[model samples]
Target: MDISTVEDALVTDAKAHLIQPWPTSGQIGAEARSGLMDGDGIYVTDMEGRRLIDGPAGMWCTNVGHRCEPIARTLYDQAMALSYSSPWYTMSEPSVRLSKRLAGHAPGDLEHVFYTTGGSSAVETALRFMQFSNNVTGRAEKKLIIARQGAYHGSTYLSASLNGRPRDHDWMDSASDLVVKLTCPNPFRRPSDMTEPEFCDFLIGELRDVIETRGAENIGAFVAEPIMASGGVIVPPQAYLKRMRALCQENDILFIADEVVTAFGRLGHVFASKEVFDIEPDIITFAKGVTSGYFPLGGAMISSKLLERLRSSNHSDAMFAHGLTYSSHPIGCAVALTNLDLLEQGLLAHAQEIAPYFQSQLKTLEDLPLVGEVRGLGLMACVECVADRKSNNPLALDLEVGKRIDAHCQRLGLLVRPLIHMCVMSPPLTITRPQIDDLVSILRQGIKLTMDELVREGLWRG
Candidate 1:
């Protein structure tokens, strides 16, 4: 059959069986698919049947991969015992135990677990809770939230409003009133010659400027990822978050850490905040790795001080009055607990130790001419593409370089995320060394192929 016929057959097969996204075929393959496909144990199998090592574990969520008897057994037993329960009134053992376990790992007084269906909802909950707490404490004017310019918190209406992505504004217009976005701390594209200390000073100054202009009188909190994700894996210069926290304190603004992409063993610690830059945010949002992507679950770990103030209720306020029917889902919580046990047992350490290996693999990507910068810590990394590395001019908008590399990877049997012109690495933490090495090899090959294609297409010249 011709290529389009074969492609149509594949598409038809998917369409016949899958309910699809509005634009996408429902699955996340691109207008073009990334080159690599995942197979069992760090290898992804593509449509053509080639198996490639999955370097960044499935969107950086799979701390435990493929098949693990322990995790599966936990799911099975939990499902059999009781898969469904309303956490609002009656509760399940797994749900109760999961909350305590999460609290145990959380820092400072961030001890209460409020569940959600996923990360976006978790973020919305964190933001809403902060606003509610502020209102309860007689600070009704504190409603404005400070978000980072390029962070991806969530995609819900309010959550999307708070997103810092420029594309977000282009896609939806009515979201500006809810969030005030600050600049991202990327040392490359928006290079700041400032030392780590100076960088923090600069960002804090910017935030301070915002508070000054907008008046913290109307701001509720400032939320950011411990490490920026989706918008490009931008690891902050040291002391940025701490300084931000101090700034928030100075302005009486709540500091929130959006840990959706950095949580679990992705950064080698239980949470990214704990792994590096030990700043304690008043609210922390998490999802993705909580159950290693086995079950849908997300939550916020609210500090004791904040919850205490919010829960007191000046007479009657209706228990914060926000939640979904599946707020504290039983099966989701159960799976998360089992995942937590596995994490505590040893996966976290293994994931952390593999960072050096991941780093080593990533180091190879720097050789590509189009690559302007490569940055990451732990399993998550980003390789930014630019026309001029010196000027750090990103490949012209609409150049579609990230998707190109992703498509190449998919063709080669690998999958990856390309946010802007930066290709991110967030392979499953459970990936083996051999698998990681294979992924690196494929990445190198994919880069070479994509660069050659780009140069030929006149997008780049060497």
Candidate 2:
């Protein structure tokens, strides 16, 4: 197994062998690949040895930053002790202990844990549990899932079907009939005639109508992210989540909160379902920050009441018949356990304290002509670019504005996650106020450079 030191050879080999997720083969071949060689707190060094601030926190995970020795040590020690186990029938000490800790941190009576490989698997597990419960209780028709239009559940077949972002299902197939999509509750994108309260009312009314028209008996669950993450950090009205929760309860619909990107201190809390959003979901799916990108791990927390009901009902003998081979992997659980410890020690509090500063600095970007809106909560924020400031009309898709801004940002010593025309930022919770300032400064320059290019290309009149 000889590794290539030559840059061209490395790039060629990668192009030949690696099928990167979420990108086309032509895109990969056309782009120059830069390998990340190392990382420290809040920064990663590329193959060229250029250290840049990690802006998207490695896909909104890395809450505790990179090169965490304790997390690494825990992984190594666990692998040396007991690396793998058949989660189907066997169990490991690390998995058991981690489950107990997660239960303790989870909201309400969500005490039971079903581990998985990552966020997708966690969501899949939750959905399957809903289906299984329905089947066992003789309500097999209650299998429909409701997800919001900007929601990003996961990439697995069932979970991906719940994803409502544009182009998410472009070339892919989804079980669309099984999933229903509601309007994205983005206050920034609400109708012009509606006030905030009126918009919230309209959304709630729409949801109620959908349930009534579709028949709540046919719906098993309504899944949502407290704050839409990968879908441009779309935040709903303050009372939106609570109202939705109440509706679910009234209609016997299971509320599933997808907290993959929100949990573990991204919102300055272990779990934001109840703590930050004031709603207790019957099932909550979490991943990413669980192990702070040190290892792959995720799980679904089940409300104790649901589990008890399933046990006492005739479903007691029915097998859930769903699980990943990597479920409850010792190494992942060990890494997550240590990551939790790090967060509890101080990282969570630090995130809570610095979030205001992060949001405030990014909000200042709205002053830029190309920026349509700057919105976010806690450490997550997005800068939406537009062609016209007054009308908030988006730029042409061919402009690839987000990618252009990201390129400039990379050249200026920062890495950002670009989604279409939106630039997303979810830096590590361990980042300092000074780091926040640096991030905003780079973003400002990047946006300005993009504006200059647009003007030079005669694409914009500004």
Candidate 3:
């Protein structure tokens, strides 16, 4: 069969049998989506033969770009040597070596690592550890987790409960009783009457109020992402994370930094908690870019101070009793080690140097009448669309504004991740200045096209 025929067959099969993530009720199992055939560096080619820039970097995970030779070779070599090992009885050398390397890069007292299959499991493991630690230390009642609005932790029960994004928990049941949520620190979405500093102060004050109302003794952990990635790249105000960390410290609550989207050179660092955000978290959960999306590997780095305290506690003999069968898979660890090498060899510095240019170029999109704001940090950014500049209301234009823009951008040689009224761009670190120019140019045209459509349809006037 020809390539087009094969692509059609694949799509038919998927529509018949596959149920994708976040499927709507109208097309839960029968959704027909785009068919991507191949990827190289910062671009992917669809089955239709259109080469498009990978704006979301494969769900913000492909840090070193697609088809990396070193990571590919490591996968093969490690599989040939030792493909898998049961974490229950045997531990692999790759796991041990990678753990040491990661520990060296992690900040402060985060000296130990617990491996998992992916981000959800990694976050689940961290929450379970927090619960286990409290149980063992005779503080079982302190099990309520603190999460913020617009945050995305994971899909597991405990972790999903911590997710505060819209529609995350609408159709699904969660451990709602075990979680306390705070306001999202998005400056753009803050009340019109408040200043940025005042908004920051309000967020901190709200957290303090929650702690006082619920009693800090009942709070087990405060989980957050330095910049809420899936929530439209919401970068909190300056000093926000540091202040939150201090509050967690004062209250004896564990601060969990979910860096699944930010770690491994996405933000020009191995870890962003200390180096970029100036905060040391008690537990750091990461997965996406650990192997640059080449292998399924995620882990939670634990604070040495917390571990030492647990070791000295009276219930030290109590077992945590949590382990995944593929926790330390040899192939995943080996690929991750090689991926780290690539990042350290200069990709990290490259991301740091090019980040300013990326942000500045994307910021130019705010000149469009439909664009309400252009905001992000590092290599990640979002172009939020609104009906009018004064009102800054995206709902007036409808949530599908992002989808319309994405459709236009895809036609113009780009793939954008549409999140309601926002289009997120987190291209691979290997993207050059020229590639960025192309991306921004295509995006501007796309938005302009979308604006024209809206105006013609009488949905918007600008």
For lDDT, the strongest prediction is 3
Ordered by TM-score, highest first, the candidates read 3, 2, 1
Choose the strongest candidate by TM-score.
3
How does each model score on TM-score? 0.91, 0.97, 0.99
lDDT of 2 by residue, 21-108 (tens): 7777567644446677689999998766678999999999999999989988897898899989999889999999999999999999
lDDT of 3 by residue, 1-462 (tens): 788898999999999999998898999999878989999999999988899999999989999999888888888898899988899998999999999999999999898999999999999999999999999888999999999999999999999999998699988999999999999999999999999999999999999999999999899999999999998899999899999999999999999999999899888999999999999999999999998888889999999988987899998579999998889888999999998999999999999999999999999998899999999999999999988889888846556899999999999999999999999999999999999999999999999999999889888878
lDDT of 3: 0.93
Instruction: Give the alpha carbon lDDT tens digit for every residue of 1-462 in model 1.
Output: 754566667666664665433243345433333223335756666556667556556666777875667777878887888878876678777778888988888888889989998998998898888777777777877898888888887878778887777766674654587778788887664444666666667787899899999998898888888888887888887777888888888877888898998888888878767557778888889998998877888999998987677567683553578888787787888888888888888888898798888888788788878888788888888888888867778878453887888778877766777676778888877777877777777777777888899778886874
lDDT of each: 0.78, 0.92, 0.93
Indicate the worst ten consecutive residues by lDDT in candidate 3. 391-400
Q: Give the TM-score of candidate 3.
A: 0.99
Pairwise lDDT winner, candidates 1 and 2? 2
